[model samples]
Every structure is written in structure tokens, then in C-alpha cells.
Target chain A: MLKKERQALIIKQINLHNKVLSSDLSLTLNVSEDTVRRDLHELAQENKIIKVHGGALSKSYNVTSQQSDTYAYEEKNIIALKTISLIKEGMTILTSGGTTMRAIARALPSNLKATFITMSPLIALELIEHPNLEVILLGGKLSNDSKISVGGEVVNRINEIKADLCILGINGLDFDGITDSDWEIVQVKKAIINASRVVIASTISEKLNSALRLKVCNLKEVDYLITELPSDSPTLLAFKEKVNHIL
Target chain B: MLKKERQALIIKQINLHNKVLSSDLSLTLNVSEDTVRRDLHELAQENKIIKVHGGALSKSYNVTSQQSDTYAYEEKNIIALKTISLIKEGMTILTSGGTTMRAIARALPSNLKATFITMSPLIALELIEHPNLEVILLGGKLSNDSKISVGGEVVNRINEIKADLCILGINGLDFDGITDSDWEIVQVKKAIINASRVVIASTISEKLNSALRLKVCNLKEVDYLITELPSDSPTLLAFKEKVNHIL
Candidate 1:
């Protein structure tokens, strides 16, 4: 077998079983144990796997895949399903990156057709998985901490596209306004809100009424508020008075 | 433990073994078999693993990690090493996306400081792993097949930067000049060539003398031609005559 194919298979094996004996990999791949050890060593160097005395262990998966089991996974899933009700066919959508937004992307119907624009390469990759979605990735200096595109270049690109709706995954939301920790992301979010006709801010209930250092937009600018909580719940009563819709 | 943490641990365990018995997981995690089974089911639904009658297996590893084992793996490693020799600390580098460039990124010295720019998100992510490197991702319409940003936006961004070197992984090269099949990528490469002071074309020796449908640049435009073959080898004789440096 080709080395690439063999190593790929070995990775699959390790991921599936959580551990793999070098002897077994050699037996399965029909390569010498020396070759298997060498493959493990290379994979280890890549940070893809951990090499032990007799076998290898998979590196813990990254956050993208780990999103499914993230904190408040159930709540996020609820918001994801609820947010889907607001999206319609043939809409141009702008999105911010977060686990909550990813949940909404995952819950999207396979047949839904839309154009998705985002500064997050990871989110762009996820959005493209939907067959009917056209994904445009806005590029600029990639923030090492946020993994999202930033700078005046990205903001300029956002101004060129008049999106039908904007789905913002915000860090903080309160009667004062939407807020976030990073200044660059806040700038990008400000552009997204202005480029779209309507804005929907999605956050977990725990984040409601919370504020951060950098302000994004006023609570009045957000046309819709989405959370896992029931629309009629007392927790949302104050927000419901400010936003057009709460779900 | 949080379900996210538990599931992440479960994923790590499954990745290590390539297959894990449900009963074994229950004992190791100190959870009921039912909980283990539920965890396995949720992971399966996410397409993270394959559920079998008795256990689960991992999806094969992706192309980035598999680059080490890719076609002409050894040859690419040689090219990668040679390419590193051309790099000096504190230079601004522009790179095209491919296994060869990734190999070079992997081989970079830990202490080297450089600003790397690219239209590939995958490359940007890989480049950021190097502590001293600043990664700029040029964004535009992401081509589904190539996974590289294309369109006027990316080209405009390239025009704004004066890079010290452009390391391109090309599809074809001949006495006729550099050729590729994709027009969008060709456009991006043309901009890369115009923006950089020096251009290094790296490819496996086997790709030499080949031609694709679209043209990228003339043979003389490339300052350096890098192949796995030794510079004095008979195969490089023709290319050595046109390019200033053959490595």
C-alpha cells in the first residue's frame, strides 16, 4: 500500500479504538513493524498522535469536533433548531463564528439554499458541507486567538455585500448593547450588523444581560434575539421589549 | 465530569485504540454501560466514528496530517529541506497551498521569524503553529475543489504586499513555462509572482516537463527551480539553463 494510504488507515484505526498495538498495525497494513514504528514517530511529531512504548494514542481531537459535546450542548442545540425557523430560502446570510452558530449550521436542512459569508475559515468549511450553500470566506490577518479574519480589509469586503440577514454569535448581550472581548472581532461584527438588513443575535441564556469591554451594537439594533429559553419566559421579558422578536 | 469533557476523553480513547469495546469503556470511564453506549451513539451521529456491532472505528485521517505519507513523500521531504535552506530569518514569505509547501512549513526552524502570507486557510493555520511567524490569509470566494481563496479580492490583497519570496507548488512546469488547470488559481499565482521579489517553484521531479491547460508564468520568471533531484542531475539540465538557481 502507498505510505499515505497506510498512515491514513492507521490514524483511522487509532481513532476508532483509542489505542493500537504496533504489531497489529503491521499485521493489518502488511508492512514491517519497523515501518509501522516509523509512521507512528512521524505522526507523533505532527502532533496527530502520541507514541507510547508499544503503540500510539490519538491526540485529543480539536474544538471543531469537540463542539458537539461542549458546555450547554443541549441548550445550543435547542437554539440551533429554533434559529432555523427564522431562515428562509434564497436569503443571503452573514454569520459570526462560535459553537452556537456551528450548531445552527449543522441543523440546517440539507435542501436549504443560501449564500453564507463569514470571516471564519472553520465556519466557511462547515457551511460548505451543505450542498446548496454558497460559502464566501472573507480573508485578512488571521487572529491567533480567535481563528477569524480581522482588519480593515475584511470590514471593507463586508460593506460590498448587502446580506439579507446577519446571525451573530456574541460574547455578551445586555440592555446596554452587544459586547465582546476582542477589539478586532468587535469591528468585524459591527460591519456585519451594518451590511445586513436585519440582525439576529444568538447567545446562551447565561450570557443574557452580561456586558464586555468592547461594545458591538445597541440592543435596539438587533431585530431578533434567540436563546434556549422559552420566548415567554420571564428571563426574556426585558429583552423581548427591546428586540422585534425573541425565540 | 461535563459531558463535553467525558466525550472528549472518550474520543481520545477511541482514537488511541482504533476500536474500543463498550464494556471496556464503561469500566475505564467509571460509567454505566448505558452511558458509554449513549456516548458512542452521539459520537457516531456526529460522524466522528463508525459504530460496529461490538465497537467503533475512526474515520481515516485528513490530507494535512497525511501529507507526511503522501505521494513522493521522501522526495517532497528532500525538496522541503532544500527549500528551508533558501529561507532566511525575518523574511516575508508568500506560499501556495500543497503538500510540498506544508512539508516546508513543518521543516522550518523553530526560532526563525518571518511573516507568511497565503490565500489558503489551511496554510495559514499551519503557518501560525510556528511561534515566530505571522500568518495573513487572503480571503475571497473559496473554490470548493481547491480550497484556496480566489477572485479579485485575493489578488488585490496580494498587490498590496511586497513579499520577499513566493514559494509556489505548481501543477505543471516545462520549457514552455508554468501551467495549471484552474484559471482562478492561475490568476492568484500570477499576482503572487508580480508581488514577490523572488519566486521559487518547487515540485517533485516527476512533474517536470509536464503541461496543463492554463499558463501561470514563463520559465524565466521563476528565480529558483526546486525539485527532489540533485541540481547536477541530467533531468535538471534543461531547467538549469533557464532558471537562475536550480536546487
Candidate 2:
């Protein structure tokens, strides 16, 4: 195959599979791993894909480029559907910023009357058309990559509100606790933990064993942990043992 | 000339001059304004340039884009240099998010002692290595376009602190007041205005006489308005008349 054709094939594979290992692509394309790596680097430079630790992932899968709402659509939809089960009319809720939270915002039924206090611009935009829902955006310094607010101001504002429920989108969670990738994010999460009456974490199964740089709260702080997979999964069981509840 | 060459030439002209009139481009190119408009439209489609009310402006000149820091480097440097002059040792200062502010953050003297509070992740990242600076990042919803935090939580945090100075980057300013293009941004700016003892606005001359969707604070609320040009400039004079001070 021509060099352009092979590169195009690699891109197609990444788009199809969400991620591709360099070695795998090398073998598939009948090229050396070094050549595949070079192609991936060039493609990444073109913003066609993202170079991960050992491979390439579709840039579209990353939430920072576009609105976070566009990523993990199915997972977010399932998480949102599961999350809405915990909501009740007239309840005041605090939702954090993430693709999952954005999905929940979009999936919220218009008939469900509730007050939402959020630190996500995408959420505010999503909730703008909802007449029955009152959305209060927590203002602070913006993080361009995450499209979420983080800083002391966001934390202080979260502290002032007493929410019936807080639906947190976990960056990473292990048996020990909920963790965040950024130190600034931890500050906001800490405030959310202090203000909410019931803390609910909406995360995917993949994030169970992962831990990031900052620790927000212990698993004990979470009232419930919801994931798309079945409740009997080992990760869920481990989390259930540490936290108060699981969904 | 070929269509692509003509389009490239127009784009080059706009980048070279900063602004160009459609009629002038038409006359210079010996083509009708309608053809120039079509070429501009095509270039805009390819993200080569942006179509303004009258003619095209170089996308390279857009300060909000990912590579915006590269363009307008001289103007941003001057603004940063002037802005840093306002900072003093041990004073707590609030800075809004923008390429201009980011430049200011970069230009800050490493030995200067101050508590720098902001919602811009880029600024926070830049300040991490500053030994003498205490960086407090305000948390809230993040806006991807501007990479600034906004919303209630961020606002509440701002209200809790009384900063010595607040340095703001104006989106659009008019005879009436300072306006933001986004609704949530207005809330964030209002919080910033209320939290600081002195409000300083840093903007270019062209930003004046324009209004955006969200109103932050009126010119009267500002303690000082700083621009690149002298205070006697027509736009600055208009702004100076509405406010108590100019820098």
C-alpha cells in the first residue's frame, strides 16, 4: 500500500476502535513499529488522533477538544439514566463538571422540577432551555480543557449551598476513595463533599482501579457509587465494602 | 489568478494589515467586492480567516483560539508590562482569564511577593514554580472558548475574599459598561467586581464602543481602565469620562 493509504488505514482503525496499539497497527499495516509510531506522531500533530502512552486514541474520544457532552455518549447516557432515578421533584442538587454530568443534564426530563447548582458551563447551556428547572451556575475561574470551574471561589460557593443530592463525576476511584487528576479539582470536590446531604458518584467501571494526582474524599464519603456494569462486579464489590452504598 | 491563490492573497493582506476594507480589497485586486466576499467566505470555511461585519480578519489574530498567544504578542506584552506595574509585594490580586492575563502571568517578576488568585488553569500552571507567589485558583464552571471559570460557586468564593486589586480583561466595553459575550461570564465578572477593593480593566482600543450579551460592571464601577494607547485616545477618552480613573 502507498504511504498515504497505510496512514489513512491506521487512522481508520483508530476511529473504528477508539484506540490502537502501535505494535498492532505495525503488524496490520506490514510496517515496523517505529514507522507506525512516526505515522501516529504525524497524525497526532495534525490533530487527527491523540498519542497515548503506548498507542493512539481517537482525538474525538477526548472531551477537551469539543464540548464534553459529545464524548462517551452511550456511557454517559446510561449513567444519566441511572442517575435520574435518584432525583426527585423540587430537590436541590449539586452536579460537578464532566461529560457524565453533562449527559445527566441533557437527559433530565423537563417535567422534573428541580433546582440545579453546577460548576459546568456546558451544563448551564444544556439547562438553559429547561423552564421547570432552575439552574444556578457556580462562578469561578474557568479551566479551558475541562470546561469546568475550579478554584477557591467555586469551592466556597459549593460550601454555601445545602444540596439534597450531589452527583459527582469521578475522574478516578479506588477502594480507598474518590481521586481527581488535578489539585485544583480536588479543592472543588472537597467543597462538594462538605455541602451535599447525600453524595452520589457516577463513574464508569474502567475508572475503578485508577487513581489520579489529587484525593478529594475517602470512599466513606460517598453515599452511593453508580456504574454501568452489573453490581456484582469485583470493582463494585470492593467499592461497596468501602463506601456506604452502591448503585 | 487561481481561486486558491486569490484566497491566499486576501488572507495574507488581512494578516499583514490587521484589518482591511472589502471595497479597498476589491479595487486593489481589480475584482468586484462580491468576488472578494466569496473568496473571504471560502477562506473562512477553511478556518484560514474570520469574516467580520465589513471584511475578513486573520484567524491568526483571534486571541481566543488555541494558538492565540502567538499572535498579538507585542500588544499582549505591552499590556502585561503595564499590568505588572500595578502589582505590589504582599498584595492579593484577582485576575480574569484571557491571553492578555496569561501573558501578564508569564511576565510577573518571579521575586515579587503576592497572593495571586485566578480561575485560569494556564495561569495557575505558570505560577506553580514561583516560590514567592501564593496562587489561589478560584473554582467554578470552566468555559472552553476563553478558558476562564464562571458560575455561582466561583462567584461565592470571590465574595468571600477582599482582594487588594482585581485586574480584568474586557471582552467588549461600551459607553454604558463592560459587557461579556456570554451570560455566565457576566455573573463571574459581577462577583469579581464585588470581591475586589479596586477594579482595573485592561483592554485594547478597538474593544470599546461594543456591547456583548452579558453586562459585567459599568465603567463607573472600575477604579482604573488601562489600555495600550494614551488616555487621550478617542476611545479611552470616552471610557475615561464614564469612569473615575484611567491608567
Candidate 3:
């Protein structure tokens, strides 16, 4: 593989697992240990990752304030700004957690007044910064990997609320459905979709056509799809027919 | 007042109100605005506060990661270590949010197995670092100042669960009761006290014998009082008769 392609894959691995072992990367990439070490060191020096004794940790995973160092932060921030245009005054919005959602919360206009219901504590913390916004945190057993509330309690709470909009920061978006690896989080995401009148899927362009272990919902269920790229970009052309609107 | 005394009071004021303007501090302290500005600048230089254009913010109130710059961090950490001795294996621990509780969560042993229920999203994020701990975040409307879920929903959730131990990072503890400034948070703390089998109040020595506007519970309700001071310290003598133990 090309060096750029190999480094991108390593970053993807770190983003997925929050932490990656150099030994495991060496085995998976079929590269020597020295090559893996060099890649990790280069990434660390670039402020992309925090190199540890045995491996490296994603910057966003450890520090919530260090969004500048997050993988694809610029693209995610673009998605955040685009997502803001959909929000209206006095609307009740439900949200699932991820770096994309965090960016959205940070980018919200200070004058906008809305009610936000989220399963992620980090997002809830960020949303409360807006004086005009009301933030409701869905309480339940928190998933360590996802850093959001999950389990049956969260779904039960979602069932009782009728929100005007739902924003999902999904892992994968394929022709069939929105898929994620964790079953509990997927369950919460599914409930969120059912509870809202309109559902918007916000992701980066790279997540297009990707599928994970578990399916969350079908592409038809999403009313809007927002990505970093322009609506007329060739990368999003195929998904135009799948959703009601592409932004 | 002595410069040391004035600076100490300034830190106390910052802790009470997350953000304080130099003009307000000058009026409250009966000092010139220039003196207040100089004090804020010195505190900012020591990394004790984050000075802004017209005022300053408590280090712990904004960036959760910058705990080292938190006021009396060493004292709070010492209390955290002592509080750990009270926990046993497989206990269900309920926590309130504050720098003191955050210290305790960070100090928890990795091998210890326990379940933690908390209203603060920040504490939940900190507690999840322990692999063996189960973290349940009570969902409700989040308080912007406290950064914890508050309201009827949170109190109802606390009513359902019977926690083995409740750890309260109280603002004030006096002969009358455990007190705080916010009415909504005091209600939630009162509920937590009634829902737990034993209540533990963790606070710094400075807060001892201080009383705020709202009362959470009576002194007799607390099972233990843990502070940075030794149990036999003269500062704790007044509180010795009110609680079962003081550490």
C-alpha cells in the first residue's frame, strides 16, 4: 500500500477503537514493527495522536476540549455548520453522540432557542453553554466505548418523547441502512429515529457506503443527509435518491 | 485587608460564582478596581484562574481537564485518597459533581469493582475510566452552572434506586445542615440522601461550618464527613460531635 494510504488506515483504526496497539497494527498491516512505530511517531509529532508506551490514543477520546486535533475535525466541523441550518426556533431536537454532534453543539448560534435531548453527557455539557437552549440528558447506563447513555432505560425514555427532529452521528451509511458496531447504541439510535418527526443523518463523505456489524435503520428512514462536501459533489450523487434532501 | 487575605477571598468568590467581574470584586472587597485587576492578573499568572477581558473564571468550571489549576487541588486530592478507604468491593456508589468528587473518581483504584450512579455528566465521564465500574447517569434537564442533571426526572430516578453509599460534594456544612446555593440542586441532593443507605459528605476544610442559602440535609443525616484535614485536627473538632466519623 502507498504510505499515505497506510497512515490513513492507521488513523481510522485509532478513531474506531480510541486506542490502537502498534503490535496489532503491524500484524494487521503485514508490516514490520519498526514501520508501525515510525508511523505512530510521525502521527504523534503532527499532533494527530497521543503516543503512549505501547500504543496511541485518539486526541478527541481523551480530551473533550482538544477538538482541533480530532481526526477530520475540519470536515466534521463543516458538517456541524451545515447541520445548524436545519434547526428552527422552539423545536425539540433529539441527538445521538459523536465528534460530529459535539461540533454541532459548539457551532450552534447563541441566539437560537431550542430544546435538545441527547444520550451523550459530553454533548449535553456542550449544549448547556448556550443560554437560550434547553438541554435534557437521557439518563441510563453509560457505554464506556461510546461515552453515551444506553440500555433499555434510554430507549424507554425516547419512547415517551415526541421530538420534532433527530440528529444522528452515525458510523456507517450504506444503501441498505445506517449501521454501527455496538448493539446497545444502535438500539438507542433506532428508538431516537422512531421518536422524531424528521431524522437527519450527519456524517463525513468517507463514511458513505460503509457498513458495520449491526444495522440501525434504512436509508429511506432518513429525511436529510448532511456531509462535509457540497450537495452537488460527485461523491454524494449516488445518495441523492436515497434521502429526501442532501446538503 | 492583607493582600493574601484579599486574594484568598477572591478565589472563594470565583468558586461561588464561576465568573466574576473585576468591578464586582472591587465593590465586594472594598478595594480599588486596579487592586482587583492586579490580583486577578497574579492569580492568572499562577494558573489559578482564567482572566478574561473584564473578569476571571474558575479553572474547574470551564476546562475539566485542567484540574491541576483548580483551587486547592492538593487538598482535594488528599481528601479523595481518604474517602477511598470507606469504599468496599461491589458497592453501589452515588456521586455528586464537584472538583472534590472528580478527584475521588480519578483516584479510584483500577481493580476495584463497584457501580457508580451520578447526576453529573462530567463525573460519569471520569468514572467510566475505571473498567470495573458501572456508571449510570441520571437524566433530566441539565443545570448550566452545576453541569449536572436536575429537575423532577432526576429526583424520580434517584427515588427508584437504593444506593449503598451517597457521596455529596457539599458547598457548606454547618451545625444546622448541609447547605448549597442553588435550590434545584439542593432538592436533588436531598433525594440522594434519602435514597442511600449511608450518606458521606466530602468537602474541603475551607467549607467546614459554612452555610449557604438552601439546606440539603441536617448534620445528623450524614454518616461521615471526610475532609483534607486529619480527623484529630482542631478544625474538625466542632464537627466531630455532629457526624459518626471525620477524616
Q: Pick the candidate with the highest TM-score.
A: 3
Per-residue lDDT of model 1, residues B134-247, tens digit only: 888888788877878899978888999899999999789999999999999999999999999999999998999999999999999999999999999999998777888999
DockQ of 2: 0.10
Residue A37 CA displacement from its true place in model 1, Å: 44
Query: Which residue runs of candidate 2 sit more than 4 Å off their true CA positions?
Result: A1-92, A95-160, A169-198, A202-223, A227-247, B1-51, B54-74, B97-99, B106-112, B118-132, B136-162, B171-199, B209-225, B229-247
Error of 3 at A123 (Å): 0.7
DockQ of all predictions against the true structure, Cα-based: 0.20, 0.10, 0.34
A100-203, model 2: which lDDT tens digit per residue?
88788888897889888787655665664455777666655556466566777677677788999999999999876888878787888888878999999998
Task: Assess each prediction's global lDDT (C-alpha) against the native.
Answer: 0.85, 0.76, 0.88
Number of the predicted model whose DockQ against the real structure is largest: 3
Name the lDDT value of residue B20 in candidate 2.
Answer: 67
Give the least accurate 10-residue stretch of model 3 chain A, judged by summed lDDT.
A1-10
By DockQ rank, best first, the candidates go 3, 1, 2
TM accuracy, model 2: 0.49
Clash pairs (backbone) in predicted model 3: none
